[model samples]
Target: MNSIIYGPVPSWRLGRSLGVDLLCAPGKTCSFDCVYCQLGRTTSATTERREFVSMARLTEELKEVRGINADYVTFSGTGEPTIASNLGQAIDLARSILHLPIAVLTNSSLISREDVRGDLAKADVVVAKLDAHSQELLRQVNRPMAGLMLSDIIAGIKLFKSKFTGKLCLQIMFIEANKNFAVEIAQVASCLLPDELQLNTPLRPCPVKPLPPPQMASIKGNFHNFRNVVTVYEAPRPEVKPLNLQETLRRRPKL
Candidate 1:
């Protein structure tokens, strides 16, 4: 079987996370062609749920890497994890097959649907995204598929947080384009009542530059009222062993 369980990569939030690619398609596949995405653009961006990667194959591949030491088994790869039809099954099966806790990183485009929220709830931790507060800004930055409303995504995040028992972290990736509205975005996140708030910036091989640490710190001031808020730019990172050269390049290569 192909190495479906890749990485024990260094993550700012989750120590050494082993990645499980549920939608390891040929290229970048996502609901949004984010301007700051590490993988450039989404070639197969769609909201339709399908068997992008089979559960049986995931199980077989995971079994091959059972001996690898990891802190978390993350459902994240080339695109949105929620787009997979069997994401819930994958998480449940992974728990039985692996000792590590499961985490799902989603863009939050599909969270408006009950099925998407329910599927994400199975994970121990969920990192949901919210980059813009206005529709125009959302389109400029996230460039989501047609018919995806910013209001609906925000409402969905709040709804999911209300029902989910696991840890919920709201990721707000800051860029120069959305810098002015950082405070507004923070206010929206406060309403969601996420267990944790991650104020982040583009820190990958994307075309845009990351927000300056001092500037990010200034924005962090607005979120002071929200307990457990973390400035991702200031998070500590320990040495980590990546899955391999190829995997690192494919997922998130350091520039």
Candidate 2:
């Protein structure tokens, strides 16, 4: 059977993270085709939600990783984890089976829907991606599905933050396109009131080159008002070996 669970992949933010892919479909399925995506451009881009992996299968996979040394069981893979309709159920199952703190990394595309917000609320930590502040920048950077507006996304995040008791971290990916607009994106992130702010760029192999440490430091300065801030360049990367190297690379290449 194709593995729905992969990694103990090393992460700067989550330490040794075990990844769970609900949408284990052919190629990458995502709502946004980000310019700096390491898995390359999005193969399938849509806003509709559906059940791709069954709970039974996820339970079986979770059982295999019960003793794995992972800091968090992350709901992320080749696609957006929020697009999975049964995400809340999956989180519950993973938590019950593995007893690890659940984390979900979202592109903040489908959060406008109340169902999606409810699903995301199950996680212990939600790393919401907010790369652009304006509609034009949204198009240039995120290239989201049709009818996805910047204003609606921001409002959705705000609403989710208001009710979520768990940690809400805002992740801002800075590149040449949006480097100069750090202050603008920072202003927007500040309004959302994220518990932690993560400034990141494309350090992995991708179409875009990662900005040097100096540039990233300059960008971090824009958010000096924020108490907790972390940058990709300065973060620690722990040593890890995946249970299945092939499976891990299938989801996150160059791991």
Quantify all predictions' global Cα lDDT against the true fold. Answer: 0.85, 0.91
Q: Model 1 Cα displacement at 196 (Å)?
A: 0.5
Candidate 2 segments exceeding 4 Å error: 253-255
Stretches of model 1 off by over 4 angstroms after superposition: 253-255
| Candidate 1 lDDT over residue span 114-215, tens digit each | 999989999999999999989999999999999999999998998999999999999888899999997788788889998998888877768899998999
- Report the lDDT of model 1 for residue 144: 95
Please give the distance, in angstroms, between residue 51's alpha carbon in candidate 2 and its true position after superposition.
Answer: 0.3
Error of 2 at 172 (Å): 0.6
The alpha-carbon deviation from the true structure for residue 34 of candidate 1, after best TM-score superposition, in angstroms, is 0.7
Candidate 1, poorest ten consecutive residues by summed lDDT: 246-255
